[model samples]
Target: MKLKLISSIFILLGYNSFAQNAKTDLSDSLVKDKQVILAKYVPMANGEYLYKGYQIPIDSFINRVNDFRADFNAQIAKDKLSDLSILKEKDVMFYSYNVLAHYQIYYGMDSVGMENFGKVVQEKRGEPNFYKLIDSAQKKAFPKRLSNDERKRLDDIIRKSTDLNDAALFKTSAAYRTWLNDYLKGVQRKKYLADTALGYGGDNVAMLKVIAAEISDPFIKEYLLYTFTGTVIKSVKNAGAKESAYKDFMAGTTNETYKKGIMEIYINYKNMSSNAVSPDFNYTDINGKLVSLKSLRGKYVYIDVWATWCGPCKAEIPFLTKIENDYHDKNIHFVSLSVDRMADKAKWISYVNDNKLQGIQLMADKDFSSDFVKKYNINSIPRFILIDPTGKIVSGDAKRPSDPALRKQFDSLLK
Candidate 1:
C-alpha cells in the first residue's frame, strides 16, 4: 500500500511540474511571435531603424518597441480590441500609421511611390490594403458607429504626407489646421491622453524644435520657438523672470540663424544650473526607513530619478554602481529614487536588492506627482541631478558617465 501511494504522489508531482513548464513556454512563445511580427513589418537596416531623422540602432529600438507591439497584439489576439477597452483598436491603427510615417520620413519614399501613397490614402477615402486589418478590428470593436469627427481625424491623418517641406503637397493642409485643433480639443475631453497624442511629447517635440530652428519663416520660427520654450522651460512660479531673460536672448536674433542660436542658448542654460539647488525630497529606504534629502546637504549629492520598469534606468545601474564605489570616500552621497507607483514598492525593493546597488535606494511613493519631480520639471527618466556643497545651482547638464568628458569632470570634482 505504501509503495502504491509513493508512485501516485510522484505522478501528481510530475504532472504539476509539466503544467508549470508549459505555462512558461506559452508565455515565451507569445513574446517571440510578437517580435517576429514587428520584425517583419518594421524592417531594420543593419538592425537599426531611423525615425524622425534620428538613427535608432536596431537592438535599442527593438527593445523599446517590442513591449508596445506585444501588448497591442495580445489585446487583439484576445479579441478585446473594443472602443471601450483600454487598448483600443484605434490606438493600434494610429501607432502603426505613425511608425510608417517615421519610416517614410527617415527612408524618404521615391517620388512616384510618395505620390501614389498620398493619392491612395487621400483621394480614395477608403481603407488602404495595409490598414485593412486595423479597420476591420475597429469596426468590430466600436459598438456605435465612429463619430464624424473621429472619422475625419483618422482620414486626415491617413492622408497626411511624410514630407515636411512640401507645403503645397503635405497632408495637414491649411484647412486641416482647424481640424487638428478640434481633434486635440476632443482628445483633452477624454480622461487623459497618452503623451504621444498630437506629438505632445516624444520625438515630435524634438523634431518640431529642430524644424523651427532651421525654418526660414520668421513668424513660423518664432511660433515654434515660443512653443518649445513655453513647454520645455517655462515655469509659472518664475515666469516673468524667465520670460525677461528669454526676450533679451531673442532681441537680436533673426530667422536665418535664430534656431541654431537658440538651441545653443538652451544647451548653455541647461549646463549653467546643472549642479544647482538641491531639491528637497522624502522617501522610504529599502529598509523601510524614511530618508530626507536635507540630511545629505553637506556632501555632494547625486540624485537619480528612475523607475523599476524603465529599461534605460536599469541599464545605467552598473555604471552608477562603479561611480558609487569610486566616490565612496569623497564626501559624496548617491541616492536613487524610484518613481514607481506605491503599489510597486515590493518590486522596487526587489530590483534594488537584485542589482546589488551600493547607492542608497529609495522609493518615490508619490510617483510622478512627487513634489520634487514637479519642481525639477522632470518629463523623462534616467535623469541625473547633482547638488553642490552650498546648495546653490551650479551645473545642471552633467554628462552621463559613459561620456569621457563627464568622467573627467567627475574625477576632478571628486578631487
Candidate 2:
C-alpha cells in the first residue's frame, strides 16, 4: 500500500522534468499525423479530501493521477508545449478515472478482503453522482486568463470530447481489467459476497454507470459500460448464462476485435468445466516411461499444469509438495504435467532429478500448444486441475496450492 502511494506521487512529480524539456514535435514518437482529441476530465484530491475520507491506496492512485494531470497542464503552460505533447497529454485524460473505477471495484469486492475498501463501500455504496464532483473540481481549477469562447471550447473538447469512439476506446481499456482475474473465479463460486450471484457485476456496474454518466466523453461512457458488460460475460461460470451475456455484449458492441476476444473467452470455457471429460495426453514421464492421463483413472488426480522454466510454477512447487505429503497414502493421485518444449526434455528431467520431485512427472509431447493443453483452453500457468476417479473433471480451473482454499477443496473431496 505504501509502495503504491509513493509510486503515484512519483508519477505526478516525474512529469515535471518531462514538461521542462518539452520538444518541438512528437511526430517521431507517434507514427500517425492525426491527433485523437478527447475530453480531459481530471479528478482532484486535496489534502482534506484524503484526511476526511477516501484514504485507500486505490484512492491515492486516483488522486495522484488527478494531481499529475494538473501538474502536466501547468508544465505545458510553463514551457508553451507543442500541440502534439498537449494532444498526447489530453488523449490520456480519462485514463486515471478509468483506472480508479477499475481498482475501486476490485478492492470493493468481498474476496479481496480489504477492510478500508469495504468501509468505503458501506458508507458510500449507493447511487453515484460523480458529475457534480467533477463540476465542482473543474470550477476551482479554472484559469482566469481565458476568454468566454476559449473557456467554452476548453469545456467542450477537454471535458466532453466530440469525437469519442467506443470501439477504439475498448481496444485500450484491457489494462484496467488485468487486476480482475483472481477475484473473478472466487466471485463465480459464491465464495465472496453473500448477496452477489455467480455472475453478478452489479456492484461494479452500478458505480460504473455513475462514472459513465459523469464522463462527458462518449467513448469513456461506452467504455465504462463495456467494463460492466464484459465483466459479467467473463465472471459467470454457468454456460447458459455466459452464452446469453456474450450474445448481449456482442449485440451491443461495434468493436470487432473486442467482440471476437470476448466471444473467444466464452467459447474456450464451453464444455470445459466440471463433469467435462478430462483431455488425455499420450506422453512420457521423466523416467522415460510412457504415461497418459487415462491410465490414472481409478484414483482421484490432482494435476498441476506447469512448465520447468516458469517462475510462478516453481513458486507453487513447495506448497504443492506439502499437499502431496499430507495426503500421501490416500486414494488421491498427484501428477505434475510439464508443458515444456520437446527440446527441453533433458533439462526437465535434470530438474526433476535434482529436486527429487514427488508425484508423476510427465512432459507434453509438444510445448504449450499440445492438443491436451488446447482442449482445456489453457493459457496461463501454473494452472491446477482436479479429476474424479471416473476421468471427469472436478474443477478444470482449481485453486492454486498457495491459496488456503485449496486445502478446503481437497478436504471436501478426500474426506
Candidate 3:
C-alpha cells in the first residue's frame, strides 16, 4: 500500500510540472506569432497598394484587406493582456489597428478608417493615432503653404472632425506625440501666416497662454509648451521680450525638464541681449600675446566666432577678408576669434598660418566652454557679433559676413 501511494504522488507531481511547461510554451508561441503578424502586414507603396495604380480590382482588394484585418484582430483577441506589465500584447493590438487604418484609407473607405480611429483614442491602454502614422501621406497631400482661402477650407474640415481626447495616449504612443507635434506646427504656421511677426519674442506670449487655456489635456499642453516655448525664445531678437516670454512660459508650467531647458536658454539670451555689457575675453593672439576686448575699446568690435573644422566658416573667409580690407581704415575692429579645442591649438595655428587668415586672429583658452563663448551661448560655429565702443553689445547675434545686410548695417553704423 505504501509503495502504491508513493508511485501515485510522483505521477501527480510529474503531471503538474508538465502542465506548467506546456503553458509557458504556449505563451512564448503567442508572443512570437504576434511579432510575426505585426511585421508581415505593412501595406506597400506608401500604404496606397490598392489605389496607387496597382491595377487590382476594387472588390478583390477590399476582400483581401478585410480578411487580413479579421485575422489580425483574431490574433489580438487571443493575445489579450490583463495588465500593462508586458507591452508585447499591447503592441500587437496597436499594430493591428495601425494596419487596419492604413488599408481602410487607401481602399477608399474613409468612413470605416475614421470609425476605427475613433475606437483607438477611447481605448485605454495603447497609442492609436492614425494621423501620426500617415505623416508621409499628409505631407504628400499638402506639400506647400496654402493660400488663405485654401487654409480656411482645410481648417473647416479639421474643425468639423470629432473624436475622443485621451491624455494617457502621450504616455504610450510615439505616434500620439508625433501627431501633437504636427498639430502644434500647424497652429504655429497658421499664426505665422496670419501675421508674419507673430513669434518674434513677446508677440507669441499671448498665443502661448491662449493655447494652454484651449488645450485642457495636461500631457498635450505640457508638450506644446515645451516645443512652442523653444520656438518663441529662439525667434525673440529683443532681450527684454525674450526674458518676458521665458518668465511667462516658465511660470505657466510645473514641468522641471521644460523649465530647466528654458532657464538655460534665458540665461544665454540675457547675457547676449542688445545693449547688455559684452562678455570680456582674454585670449592669445596669433603672435602669442594676450589680446583683451577691453584693450580694443573706443572702437566698434566685429568678432567672428568660428572654428577650424567648420566648412561654412571657411566658406565665409573670403567675404570676411574682403570686408576687413574694405573697412581696414574704419573705426570697427575685425577680430576673428577661433574656439578650437586646446589640444588642437597647433592645428588651428597651422590652418590660420597656411591660409594666411586676416584680421586679429585669436583663440579661446577653452573651446566652447570659455567664459565669453558660454556667456554668448555660442553652440554653432561661424557666429558674428558687433560690440559698441563702451563695451556694450550692439548686435549679440549679428549678420554673417556673406550677407549684404551685414555690409549695409556696417555702412549705417559707420556713417
The TM-score values for the models, in the order shown, are: 0.44, 0.45, 0.47
Our tally of clashes for model 3 stands at 0
lDDT of 1 by residue, 1-415 (tens): 2232222222322211111000011111112233245555455455444222224433344344545556675766666534333323333433444543333223322334333433333333323463554333323322233344644554455445322232221122322222222333333334333245334333323433354434454544454444444344422224344444356446635654554544544544454455446557778899989998887778777777788766456556667777778778887888888888899888888888886877888888678767676555555666677777666544443455444565677677777
Candidate 1 minimal-lDDT segment of 10 residues: 17-26
Q: Each model's C-alpha lDDT?
A: 0.49, 0.54, 0.59
Can you give the lDDT of residue 358 in candidate 3? Answer: 89
Better of 1 and 2 by lDDT: 2
Best by lDDT: 3
Model 3 poorest ten-residue lDDT run: 16-25
Across 1-415, the per-residue lDDT of candidate 3 in tens digits comes to 2232222222322211111000011122223443344334333443333223222333444454446556655655664464432343433334344343333223232333433333332232123554363333333332332345643543443333222244554455543344444444446545533333543344355456646655778866766666556656655555555566677778888988778877876776766664788889999999899999999899999999888766456657878989999999999899999987889989999999998998899999977767887677565567889998889999877998878899999999887
Give candidate 2's whole-model lDDT. 0.54
Model 1 Cα RMSD, Å?
A: 21.2
Q: List model 2 lDDT by residue over 1-415, tens digit each.
A: 3333323322222211111111111122311211111112222243112221223344354555566556555655554547545544543454433444333322312222233332332233222753344333323322122334633543343234333333333333332222222223224334333234543444443333344343455644545455555544444445555566567667866866666666655655765654888878888887789998899999999889887766557757888888899999888999999987899889999999999999999898866667776666565567788889999888877888878898897788787
> lDDT (0-100) at residue 286 of candidate 1?
93
RMSD of 2: 14.5
Best by TM-score: 3
lDDT computed for candidate 3: 0.59
